[model samples]
Target: MPAVTADTLTLPRLPDLPQTATAWRPVREVVRAREFLEGEGFRVRRPFPGVGLANADPFLLLDHMGAVEYGPGEAKGAPWHPHRGFETVTYMIDGALEHRDSAGGGGLITDGGTQWMTAGSGVLHSELPPQDVVARGGLFHGVQLWVNLPRAEKWTPPRYQDIAARDTTLLSSGDGGALVRLVAGDVAGFRGPGATRTPITYLHATLSPGARLDLPWPEDFTAMVYVLAGRGTVGPERRPLDEGHLAVLGRGGALTAHAATPWDVLVLGGLPLNEPVARYGPFVMNTRAEIIQAIEDHQAGRLGRTQVPHVTAADEELS
Candidate 1:
């Protein structure tokens, strides 16, 4: 669960909120993530899309990978695949993953690093554990978020970004009660390293027991908080939120999280695209016809050529 770490006392702190100056966002619902096997049969807890895509507008899916410890030969990863009309943000919180796409845009995304890939138009990509992870066995945990691209940018181009741990903008709570790692978009006045095609803010935060986070938020964005580890409460009403749970928030210019114990959570929100979303296995589009076109394009090899490179033990030693 070491997504990113820093001594709060030594970091820049967020400005304290005035008691009556702003409003605390209220909790709309707390949805528990349902477990599903993804990418070569690795288990992940997905919290939305099941809740309905309308609730997560501009965002299609949220997959929470393991905090599970894997024995030798038990690790798994996503096989080569195709995507279009959206972006994938894969954040490695505890282990390493190798990402290679047809455009040759990827690398080792290990502890506290991230791989942001835009599948605009379409592309073939594969996500696999580095040979060492599968051979020697260790802990592997991460998150993959699917951000929808606007219709205008759907065919922009396929690209990628490798955001290392040190590249994240770090901040702390007013009283140094929590640590914040800004991954994308703006927070107050500070910004993250991720360059998104849509308006959004993504961040990971760790709070000490009994600590509370008062975050300045954009009123135009839809907000939600997902607990990664430990227990916590969200909103002014103090609604309960535990691990694998997501709290969808209501309108306000600010949000709050009060920890019951040491907790790690991801806070994200984005301007609602308010557009129709038609999706299938891996393709996301604005209409069923578009989705069909995507599948046809992929089957016709328009996405990109698939190159399955089986990693060998010797490869691990060299890497």
Candidate 2:
């Protein structure tokens, strides 16, 4: 039998994103459970740390949340690290993070802000507590997601983007309560920041109880809806999703998300880059040699390092 593609497939349109069948797989699902820290002591929830659930091709590791209270000395952050052949996006919901990169990119991202780091070829960097913040008590609330890079761009130059809240486009329902911020694509007649790298749509949405939100997606893309702070039900399948969990919609177009209560959720979906993925020790690549080169560059002291930002008192208390 001949193979079928999106161009040859026809389907009815829905108010949501167009449906595209992908190589859908559970890969793995993980729950972050709070763990007690020794020493200065901080509450932390470790997610996808075990080898069993790092990241699948296309999708990578997802750290749902972190709070400074999770570590001692208000220093609740990952120190200098290396990554290549992938991208990392840090989304801040309620707190701030001192972001410093090896590609001459550094800044402090606060609430409603985002920092997108492209570790294309390679880079050495760290996400840590700001200098001014010190060891005082503070709130560190946010999520960091890793996205796999295409083989062609895996060894390209590394870069970073600090996406501010104001730069993002917002779409609201006619009733005026339900809304979403388009972070990196077009949706609801609104255009996002247009970040280059992946064909992606990152939407931050909120809905009131008994309200519904419909999205128009590309017919050739796979999508997953993640509930951050409420209950959500998708499709006729009636797949119920609650807070701190993820709902991956399979084989469909035009997603229907109904809120059981007032809730916050992030709708993220993108076309697969369609390339082999090989990852090792903060580096991702299509071939083993590429991953090795990334490590060699970091070890040879050829990678760049940016300055860390200063953290404010208010920033520390942003949990």
Candidate 3:
């Protein structure tokens, strides 16, 4: 494991404020996860970039994979591909995903694990189910989030952080009805393991019936929550949100969510890039010329090559 220093692990803290009554942000819009196909025929529910909702500032896309059971040999995950000018975050909920990249990095993101990859400049990679899981066939569930990079760091060298479930910072409510797993960024004083160029917080929370959670957040960040299971109420008005619904929050210093039933939600917030976003399939850049250059680079083998040609990068040992 790599040593984690304060500089690498902690995000800059916003100025502290006098203790005041928690004010919940209102729900700006409620969007449902829409089904889509991506990464070599894998099915997903994309809540953002759908009909009603567009890009959410620093967050470019989010794909919620199945809680469905896959029969033996039925799973087909993302195949070999290239990415640039952004980072890819994969959070595993119930199954295993094997990952390999052109830079000689590879690992397995099992249940409760997360793989954070910075496809700065460019990199070739693939994510797929391990053979054992494919043969035995079991529950498969996860989410993939794309975090856009600022122009200044868009061409930084690629890197990877494979975080095991045990590495995540877990916090529980006083009554024990709510639990939060902080994967990246700072929340309630706990910092996650992954380091990000963009200041952001990514968390997964579970709320038991009748439970309420009040989490402080940076006022300037764009915040949103996606309910993975059950129904819940969010914000000061306690707007009702059913399963598969995503709630985009308005400006506030805190977020409040109450569970009508047991609920699982993914919470994400980030400081906006406030720059132009130019995207061509798999490549996100600040300009169309940069997008064209990325494509040309991939075609010309400028992105590093993987050792295993037929199997993508999954079979290579992590460097």
TM-score of each: 0.94, 0.77, 0.89
Q: Model 2 — which ten-residue stretch has the worst lDDT?
A: 1-10
> Per-residue CA lDDT of candidate 3, range 153-173, in tens?
998888777777877767765
Q: Is candidate 1 or candidate 3 better by TM-score?
A: 1
Per residue, candidate 2 scores C-alpha lDDT tens digits across 247-296 of: 55555445667788887877777777778777786877888877677678
**Candidates by TM-score, descending order:** 1, 3, 2
Off by over 4 Å in 2: 1-57, 67-72, 305-319
What shift in Å separates residue 207 of candidate 3 from its native position after superposition?
0.8
Clash number by candidate, in order: 0, 12, 0
Tell me the RMSD of model 2 versus the true structure.
Answer: 10.1
> Judged by lDDT relative to the true structure, which candidate is superior, 1 or 3?
1
- How much lDDT does each candidate structure score? 0.88, 0.62, 0.82
User: Per-residue lDDT for 121-195 in model 1, tens only?
Assistant: 888999999898899889999999999999999987787777889888899998799999999989889888888
**Which stretches of candidate 3 lie above 4 Å from their native place?**
1-20, 305-319
- What TM-score should be assigned to candidate 2? 0.77
| lDDT for 36 (candidate 3) | 90
